[model samples]
Target: MSALETVRIREAGATLAAEAARFSGYGWMRGTSGNLSLVLDRDPLVLAVTASGLDKSELTDTDIVLIDGDGVSIDGDDPRPPSAEAGLHAHIAARTGAGAVFHVHAFDAVIAGHRWPGGIELRDMEMLKGIGHSAHDETVWIPVIENDQDMTVEADHFDRVYVPATAEVPEVPVLIVANHGMYAWGADAAEARRHLEIAEWLVRFTVATR
Candidate 1:
């Protein structure tokens, strides 16, 4: 595989598309439901996200759309458009220096959403180190907020409550939208995808044990 072939895994180009494809294979993003994004820069962050509602499996570089600090597109004209949750990605990248954010609808995660009243607590899991902190002695709180139709409102809620609450601990790099899906991020796309995968595994393990 050449550099291009390796970079474009399966049918992906942008890091977001690659992660989306991986998550789709894991059955987290099905039926064109979930979305993903990655930041281009950090000193002055900019984003290139998948065009909204496109099937994650068929994603290619052509579908990746760039957005400014305000979450407005600053790239080519692909008629489809960015995901409805683009603002949420922009918010996290701007505020937290996150290079990538992966959102998905995993089966076990959805089940765990109903199981936990507030948020799911991931404690004593060795995989917790993949995120950021090395906390084998504490509970990593992954907040689960109710999903809503208003993307901007939900984004604000995430910023105001969810972001602050989770940022209190570095290891907790995930946020669950009750009954909807999950979001995970990191300094870059690879790490972010790892975070998503780890969170998915932890949730699945918790559900199976219970």
Candidate 2:
């Protein structure tokens, strides 16, 4: 990558760190159970991924490790290990061409996923537009897949369930890991944030109304 591109990626990572801190403040990332990542390059396939076991409330650019397509840390002398869920992030980035991915352990997502093992169908809400729905009446079906402790197994389950976006299928960029949390992605960090926030809100709304 060019020097300019590298600089831009660093700046973007810093911005994402701030967003992580905000999410932490909201208790979405409590217990250090959440992670976020951004794509830095496609040709060589570099990513800025969060390190494992770090407090998001104190997240900084240093907390974001640069990794390759295979989730190998490329950032020199960065002692921290990449998040264990880094494989999932790489899979999503490769399959969906998403520029950013956010996985959070929020109460609403966990509760909703448990309540509806099938999925959550959010419709007739203005927040749907935030997740790429053009009309409020359009349904946003977010899948809730069973969770697994083994990363390889979790990834295989994800691969088996995830359907690539197409003209015929409405993009389902957000999913819940049953009894776990939510994974939301978009073209960039900002868009991913919108999707995550909207999905969380809708999940909470659904649970509250029920």
Most accurate candidate by lDDT? 2
Error of 1 at 198 (Å): 0.8
Clash list (residue pairs), candidate 2: none
Runs in model 2 deviating more than 4 A are 1-6, 134-137
Q: Candidate 2's error at 63, in angstroms?
A: 1.2
What's the lDDT for residue 16 in model 2?
Answer: 71
TM-score of each: 0.84, 0.90
What 10-residue stretch in candidate 2 is worst by lDDT?
131-140
In terms of TM-score, the best-performing candidate is 2
Model 2 lDDT tens row, 44-67? 888888889988878876677777
lDDT of residue 180 for candidate 1: 85
Write one digit per residue (lDDT tens) for candidate 1, span 65-91.
767776677655545577888878888
